[model samples]
Target: MSISFLAKHPVPCSLFLLGILVLGHGAYIQAKAYLAQFLIAQAWQQTLDDQQVHKPWQWADTYPVAKLSFVTKQESIGFKHQVESVYVLAGASGRTLAFGPGLVLSGAKIGEVGNTVIAGHRDTHFANLAAVNKGDLLQVEASNGEILLYQVVNTQIAHQSDTQFMAPSDDNRLTLITCYPFNQLSGGAEQRYIVEALYVNKPSAI
Candidate 1:
């Protein structure tokens, strides 16, 4: 309809404008995520192949530090296995987490003899963590080309005030942390869902 006509029909015009705004916002969110993933994937591949730090962009303060992967069993008809991989960046800040999980700097380096903690957004890269169970195997490919294996030992929900989650340890461990209630869409989630995995063995490749 013409501008004058739309102005005359206030309710319908308001609804139409709101619809457009909603759709536009949704598209923007999707586009941002797609672009972030695209750039992160490129950096990840470069890091893996070159064994060097690769940033998604020149201005970015962080780079892909490791690759995380796990195998899942499917029971559709017969048993099938599917492998999923995600690149972990060097920082867990807002900008870094917009794309993928980030490696906490204070934590132990990947494949090192201490706790390695990684954090990701619950709604995005870490959504699959809800499906992880004890005994599930995970692979972490360090930037140095070492592939370390870990098995989930347990899962827990802890308050954000808990300092033990970030504590250093003597034994090797990998901890994946995401906001609790994976389905929540709000920001500043208070509780964390933690997946603690024990170091098992090193593999040739992920």
Candidate 2:
């Protein structure tokens, strides 16, 4: 409260300030991520309307390429269901993943019969991937207004360096990749959680 008190307990005061800074930074990051998604959603709407790429922000280097959705609940054919979705950006760079999942540039095209790879932060966008299981359904709404359906066929964890699952393939598949150990707060995780889904059908015509 006073200079005397701070000087008397410099270590404690310093630790207290450090703690506040850390918490403030974390809060700022979360706020930014949430706000960015709202803007990205608007841009996605424009892209869908014009069939063109639209950046969420003027300074952003990425644009929405697809919308990825995961079926959260399906009680029965007669009942309604719930789904969770996030916009996929153009490239999987660190800057891009901070806001939403990003599409791997080297991977196959979004709605095509190939490996469509996407990466997101475990704590944010792809956090739900941890609950996903084989046989679950995933949907991709491409920029062209085409909705493609996919059924999860596998879920695996591999070392971060393993890139086999992310490589391009001839079959119609969707690969969702996120860091392993979803609870970990640090950015560098040594493992990866991957959800692989196969193209099942076109839920509707564009």
Candidate 3:
């Protein structure tokens, strides 16, 4: 039926149509959030939490860097983990090595003896991450059940060409990365935003 004709019908019909539109939009958003959460949690469980197949790096171990599941937001699903590429140290143009949804980048490795650098996709996997603010608690779930806590220290923006954002620091650090101009349209993100956190003492796992 024509929309205008339907609108001319009884009040009940108009109310019902409005209800459908509202409910449908609500359902779509809820479903999308659930799916994102499920995908990320599953990835962490299967790859990082699998006792028989995977083990996290020891606190004393160094090198390739330990991949840990990062959870925040106090939400059912936090976000994906990623591995930091040592090559990010190599002149900045090389692609930073990373795995999606299941690995935490060891910030202790990016510079000569400084902050560890890590990155994640902003649109699908780390969208809610933009909500993360300074002082938000972050947990890095390792296979050993030892979850490390980090406190957000700062957040900033950098161009795609600004490699200094990934430069190693003198202090122990954690950097969470996602595409920037957070309000921009989907097709082309013009910049990048980074949330830097400091490694506080280890906290109990959630």
TM-scores for every predicted model: 0.86, 0.83, 0.50
lDDT of each: 0.83, 0.86, 0.53
Residue range 15-76, candidate 3, lDDT tens digits: 88899999999999889656544543444355544543321222312122233333444433
Off by over 4 Å in 1: 73-80, 202-206
lDDT of 2 by residue, 1-206 (tens): 79999999999999999999999999998798779889999999999999887888999999999998887534342212446888899999988888889899898989887899999989888989989977677878989899887878889999989999988788999999999898888777899999998998533211
Using lDDT, rank the candidates from best to worst: 2, 1, 3
Q: Kindly report the root-mean-square deviation of model 3 from the true structure over all alpha carbons.
A: 10.9
The predicted structure with the larger lDDT, 1 or 3, is 1
Clash numbers, per candidate: 0, 0, 6
Alpha-carbon lDDT of model 2: 0.86
Candidate 2 C-alpha error for residue 25, in Å: 4.7
Tens digits of per-residue lDDT, candidate 1, 50-116, equal: 7777888889899888889965633332222447888898979998888789999999988989999
Cα lDDT, model 1, residue 170: 87
Clash list (residue pairs), candidate 1: none
